[model samples]
Target: MRRKRAAGEPQWFFRRLVAIGVIGFAAWRLMMLESAPDTRVNETIAWGWILLMATVVLGYLGFASAQDIVAIFATRSGTPYAALDDPTDPPERPSEPPRNFAG
Candidate 1:
C-alpha cells in the first residue's frame, strides 16, 4: 500500500536525521552547562556556542522557507521541470502576436 520513494529520498531522510541529532546534542550541551555547578565553562564561550547553534537553526529555517517560496512560485507560473524534460531544446514560443497596452 505504500508508495515508492524517489532516488534521493533516503539520502534526504538521512541528512534530516543528522541535522536533528546535531541540534539535539547542542540543546543537551547547553542544558548541561547551565545545570552543572562544578563545571567551569567560560561565559563568553557559552555565549559564542549559543550564537553558533542559533545561526545553524536559523539558517536551516531560512533555507527551508526560501525553498518553499520557490516551489510556490514555480507551481504558480508553470511546470518547474520543463527544462529537465529536454535541456537541449529551447522553449516554445506562443504563436499569437504580442499585445500592446500603450493606449
Candidate 2:
C-alpha cells in the first residue's frame, strides 16, 4: 500500500556512479592527450566503446542492485511465492499535522 525505498539503493548506486565517473574522467583525460583527425570517424573506437558498454552491463549482473521485492502472506492463503519475506512497514512520513480536519 505504500511506496518503498529499495534496499542498498544509495550505496549500490553510489558505487556505480563512482565507477562510471572514474572511467569517464579517465576517458576524458585520454581524449585530451590523444589528438584525432577532425574528418575521420574511427570504427575501431566506436566498436571498442560498444564492447566496453556490453562488458559493463555483464558486470552489473554480478553486482546486481538489491531491491526488496518479496511479499509475505502470514495467513498462508496466497501463492507460495507470496510467502517470501520482505519489510512490512512503509517508511514514516514527515510529521506535520493537518491544519484542517473537515469531516
Candidate 3:
C-alpha cells in the first residue's frame, strides 16, 4: 500500500501533467514554422517574429497558470503553517557592496 503524503508537498501527478501539456504546446508552436507560407522576406520576418512572440506569451501564461494550480492544490491539501524563522530578526546583509555603486 502507498503511504500518505503530507500537505503542501508538491503533487507529482499534477506537476507531471502540467509539464507534459506545456512541452506539447511548445512543440506544436515549433512545428508551425514548418508550415509557414511562402512570402516576401519582410513578411516572412514579420511572421517569424509573430510566431516567436506567440510562443513566448504562451510559455509565460502556461507557467503562471501552472503555478496557480499548484498553489491551489497545496493550500487545499492541508492547513497552512506559520513561518519557522523569527520574523523580528533583521535580514542578513551581503559582506561586500553591490557592483552598481557609483559613489
Best by lDDT: 1
User: lDDT for every model?
Assistant: 0.64, 0.53, 0.62
lDDT of 1 by residue, 22-50 (tens): 77877777776785564445566567668
Error of 2 at 48 (Å): 0.3
Indicate the worst ten consecutive residues by lDDT in candidate 2.
65-74
Candidate 2: Cα lDDT at 98? 72
- Those runs of model 2 whose alpha carbons end farther than 4 Å from true positions after fitting are 1-10, 19-41, 65-103
As for candidate 3, its clashing pairs are none
User: Which lDDT value does model 1 have at 76?
Assistant: 75
Prediction 2 TM-score vs. true: 0.32
lDDT of 3 by residue, 41-67 (tens): 646765665676567668766976776
Residue 60 in candidate 1, Cα distance off native in Å: 2.1
lDDT of 3: 0.62
The residue-by-residue lDDT of candidate 2 on 1-103, one tens digit each, is 8435443222456658866875675566547545765433554564565576566766655455222222223333333233246678988989998799689
